[model samples]
Target: MATRSNQCDFIGAGGIIRDHNGDWLSGLSMNLGVGQVINDEAKRMLSGLKLASNLNTRKLEGESNLAIVAKLLIEVCPISHPLDNIINSCRHLINGFDEVQIRHIFRECNCIADALAKGSLSRDYGIVSVVETVSFDAPPPHAASAFTDDLCDLARAGSVRTRP
Candidate 1:
């Protein structure tokens, strides 16, 4: 769950909550922690353009299986969530895909995603693709680490999992 200050009003307010449940590659995670500094500096000057405007084509090189699964879930799924910030982000990320959408999952049933995240923390992976002139790739391994098990217990024991 998010902080109380941030309300869950998005239509797909729920998140998978992938909080480091696997045997992450500690070295990779540590390296990424440092690399993000450079990436942030490089990307710092690149935003504020219209939607789908990216300058780096290399960004579209690595697409991970987790993102593909998320994309799949968005298909043929029904959501009754609110219009919160998280959902807004998902919408932006999934823009132009008419068949895909965000949905609320109880988190207990999202353990697989959580495991993916933990695994990613140890290594960076992605498949890049292009839309229009913009280029983007699947979220990096470190970025994927942010995902969680949406309190659904799809695997594992309960709704809440401790980050490892």
Candidate 2:
């Protein structure tokens, strides 16, 4: 997510990694100082890809709320485009995976990640702090409710089995 104020532009990126069963494996949020929306989105993709690589994930199916970004990943990006470098990097990382696909989803379906990105904006981390990324083994407090809602929705859709 990207927000701009009179003082500065705040960019935050967050993503959740889930197994095929839809069980969360890990989550990440980053406070990326200042950047444009497109840049931030590309950075977010790069960060998520790096995290997945670090986790040694061989297959990946990434979902982005931004259709343009997802399209860029699957299509060739012009060298003159502002996000060319980042887009290329994302493609390079994707090649390392045994299988990879990036698709677009509606914002409503991406609540947890949106919450985490918003949470990054409210965090007390100093603007100039070197430590910007936060990793969570479980859902963070700010995203807990969204996480629960997601599970409930999945259960209702029969995508996942609810606990008895």
Candidate 3:
């Protein structure tokens, strides 16, 4: 997910990887500096795909709150579009996976990622590089509540099994 600060043009991108059981595998927050929202979305997707590749993940499912980015991943991006290069790079990284799927999701359902992106804007991370993007093996303190809420929601929906 990408979030832009209303006070300035600063943008932040954040994402989380989860296991099939709804357990967090990893999380990322990057200070993308000033950029267009669409550009930040494409950059975030590229960053996520790269991270997943590093983890040697054979299969991946990615979700973005921006429908345009999700659609561009599944479809051809206009060559003249500003995000064409970044979107194509994302696609290239995705092909390295044995299987991959990208889809759009509602912002409300993506609270953890949203929180992470918002948090990034409040800090002075200063132009995060792809390899240097702030990564959390577990959700950070700021995202704890959203992560917990997600787990509870998943358990209640029977998407994640609960232990006796």
**Per-prediction backbone clash count:** 39, 0, 0
RMSD per model, one decimal: 14.9, 4.9, 4.6
Residue ranges of candidate 1 with Cα displaced over 4 Å: 1-89, 124-164
Q: Compared with the true structure, what per-residue lDDT tens digits does model 3 show for residues 1-164?
A: 88877888878888887766778777888888877888887787887787777777777888887899999999989999888889989989888887777888876677888788888887675544432478888889998888898888742110111111
Q: Which number leads on lDDT? A: 3
Rate residue 26 of model 2 by lDDT.
78
Selected candidate, larger lDDT, 2 vs 3: 3
Report residue 58 deviation for candidate 3 (angstroms): 0.8
Those runs of model 3 whose alpha carbons end farther than 4 Å from true positions after fitting are: 125-132, 154-164
Report the C-alpha lDDT of model 2 over 59-127, residue by residue, as the tens digit.
Answer: 888877778988999999999988899999999999998888788777666777777777787665455
Predicted structure 2: lDDT:
0.72
lDDT of 3: 0.76
